[model samples]
Target: MEKTFKNLEIYKVKKAESVQEFYENLSLNRPGLTIPSLDTLYDVGHFNVFTRGNCGSTGPVSYNRKDYYKISLVIGEGILFYPDQQIVVDGPALLLTNPDVPYHWQAGSEAQSGYFCLFTENFIRNRNETLRETLFSRIKDHPVIHLSDAQATVFSEIFKKMMAEMDGEYIHKFDLLRNYIHLLTHEAVKICPVNEASKPTNASARLASQFIDLLERQFPIDSTDRVVELKTAHDFAAKLSVHVNHLNHAVKEVTGKTTSDHISRRIANEAIALLRYTEWNISEIGYCLGFEYPANFNIFFKKQTQSTPKAFRKV
Candidate 1:
């Protein structure tokens, strides 16, 4: 059996409390700066680097979905892992990790070195979601691209410039990182071909697939503009027009997990995303997630993740 991501001695890049926690391990967090909230459209996440043998991380990141979107320009040999795909490559490759996708990487060599910038949808929302939509459409499936040495240098320059911008005290520094991220993504589209996975072949598989999609449609909950109405397996079944037992059976048969399990896991993913990226108080966040009271959301989050919302946010 393939090892689950958490079942290995892998380096996990968990979420952070503030942007400073993101860079402090790199010896880069400036003292006396206030931590920013990721909840608002005006507030944006920042950039940082993760080098092998540093930050006590001995191996590559395990297969997982991050709460935020990431664009990593890896400069050494490594293997990229995904649920439906895996790619092993030589020197340089540009990789995108989306909140919706689960993936991991293991360095194939010790000389791993590169730059990666992490940002949220809020970061690009100010630009009117143009960059986010363009990059998403172009690279949603083909998130990795192998680059030649010279090509690597070109992308390298962009990331290097981002590092410099991050180090500088410009007020609009994050605004600038947004532009560099934009350029890096545009360059990736020019080099990679579109990749589409084949559709499922069986009825159980198709139903299970559709069920998963329906479950994920209500997510990130960036704001309280609307509330999630589907909070149970019955709700999802009703949406899919199937008996609860049938829905549960299809999901279990194809994914080896129950419908409730899928629902819970996706909810946990969204909870973590909001906790890490938003400034909404726990009650508002809970209401958005379909909980009627703050205490109930607290219990659910703690049960699903082994930590409370406040504690998880601090991590």
Candidate 2:
């Protein structure tokens, strides 16, 4: 069956559109997966259950390009779709989806049983290193890894414990749940292939992936207060701790495009989206796109698309 966001429902969080809204759209919350109100999570995140026969339809889900990350323990069959790839989850699997990448899923099995935790990067607090690990970056190609029965049991217990603590009046339950999330991901590394779960094959691919990931993560501009970063190849290289030449060569060899081309293309795409969807003035749009002056943005837009931002917006 075909599905779209309208056919489902628009979930609201904090009386606005936020990541927590995605958590509410699911029709079923199994017994063990407890979801606290979005308002209650002042600084932490939400934990929830995923059970089979929950939501009626299992088709393509709308793309999510907001803040927050999700880790799901799914038992059943499903197809995880990315822009470039799709993974088959024919058995119990551990899946990680981050804000940097957008994906949708389709169910293949008649029954689905699992637990999923949704949280932002801030929820983990001190362990920012865990969030930046290589494991989270393989969303497009290696999104899901089928788990052994024993491994599934281990993860299932962790989710149960998380829900149990949440059910109690324990004050640091969120913190404890964060630790359990770490434990869950840490255990998953053992099951995935040694090569795929770790760093890339070559230094160039590593630099290319890092650069692309860093660039992508800054996007979907969650709020007007937020603006684009890493607007230039040199800025991206500096952030990646690599020389500009090295970064350029790596990106070109891996992607068949120069580093600047990627940046310009991404920025141009954002500019178009802003002009088309937002009511912001040209200056505001330009400012958010890292353009210091309106004229400069106008020239760049014309160069990229043969039309000025104002002119394009009119069309």
Off by over 4 Å in 2: 1-17, 27-53, 56-61, 127-130, 134-141, 198-208, 212-234, 237-315
Model 1 spans > 4 angstroms off: 1-46, 49-62, 125-134, 195-233, 243-315
RMSD of each: 8.2, 12.4
Instruction: Give candidate 1's TM-score.
Output: 0.56
Give the C-alpha lDDT of model 2. 0.67
Q: After superposition, how far is residue 197 of candidate 2 from its true place, in Å?
A: 3.5
Please tell me which predicted candidate would have the highest TM-score against the true structure: 1
Mark the 10 consecutive residues where model 1 has the least summed lDDT.
48-57
Q: Tell me the whole-model lDDT of each prediction, alpha carbons only.
A: 0.67, 0.67
**Per-residue CA lDDT of candidate 2, range 106-125, in tens?**
66656777887777654553
